[model samples]
Target: MITLAEAREAYRGYAPTYDLLFGPLLQRARRRAIRAANDRPGQRVLEIGVGTGLSLPYYRPDVRLVGIDVSAEMLAKAEARARRCGLAERCQFQLMSAEAMAFADDSFDLVVALFVASTVQDLGRFGAEIGRVCRPQGRIMLVNHFSTPAGLSARLDRQLSRFAGSLGFEPYFPLDRFLAETGLRVTASAPAGLFGRLRLIEAGKG
Candidate 1:
């Protein structure tokens, strides 16, 4: 497994081009996650691995947004994006790891992870940290690509996993198992794309 430092280094040189490569598809996923969140007017939202703040614009004005990312370069991009959107005051950025968040327990009304699970070094630890900071009845929204259940897509996913390690991604996490281990219960799971390919999972603190 790669260390957080290694992942940070890998992303450092890629921050600028990161959005260009992933912006469109990820933006689509982010919109789905936001819809799953069903954010009320004044909710406190915590976003993990919030690279470049691409999802910041989707958040409602009344919702308080706190974003955390491991890469300093990515965080800088996120900061710039926040300023560009004129949401600097409402959006806060912090350099932190998802495996060990600094926030206190039960702090946020909603926590979101967008296309971020695959990058975590320790899925269990990341899930635990997410659970720790989430309020008792709060919601967690995740947008992720997973190993498809059968046939050709599953074969491709297997092939992708081999390359994923080098890129600091896990390819897929066993969604049900991870949720159970994390003390979260799935409230809804909807296909975000064709063939139930990319998924949007909305879970509540258990």
Candidate 2:
């Protein structure tokens, strides 16, 4: 498991080139996740692992947005992005952790966590926290790469997992295990991103 400190360190180094390295590759899924969030006017939306605020512009300009991340380095870049993009009218930032957010209960109508599930040290707490913050019948959306059920792809996931600490995210996250551990019930799921390697998931709090 990748520790929070390790992930922080990794992102500190990644912050410099993050947009250039991951921007294009992951942009499509980011757009898809934001679109699927379906935010309405005045709804409060919380985006965990907001990283560099690359997903900020994708959200509806009318909805209220709050972004949080554990890595200060990335959050710094994100803050700059938010300023440059004039997203302050619609969004705010906080340096916080996904596992232990400071927000009050039912604080958000929509919660989105993109490419962050496998990067945290504890998925159970990660799951519980998001669930706790979302009001009853609110929505939760996740965009991640979960391992295949079985086959060559599964084996490849296992092999790639060995470098997870360095990679800063596990490559072998299983969908069933994630659902069971996080206790997040899928309202709908669909393939997204390049070659369908990424997953776009929507769940309801109720």
Residues 1-206 of candidate 2 have per-residue lDDT tens digits of 78998899889989999999999999989988898685577779999999998998787767888999989999999888887778776788898999999999999999999999999999889999999999997899999988888889889999998888888899898988889888887889999866767889998763
Off by over 4 Å in 2: none
Please, what is the whole-model Cα lDDT of each candidate in the order they appear? Answer: 0.80, 0.88
- Candidate 1, pairs of clashing residues: none
How many residue pairs clash in model 1? 0
Off by over 4 Å in 1: 172-174, 180-183
Report the error of model 2 at residue 139, Å. Answer: 0.7
TM-score of 1: 0.91
lDDT of 1 by residue, 1-206 (tens): 45686678767867989999788856777876786584588889999989988888778877788999999999999999988888788889999999998899999999999888778787778888888899998888988877755677677766776666467566545566456555667788888864566788887765
- Strongest candidate by TM-score: 2
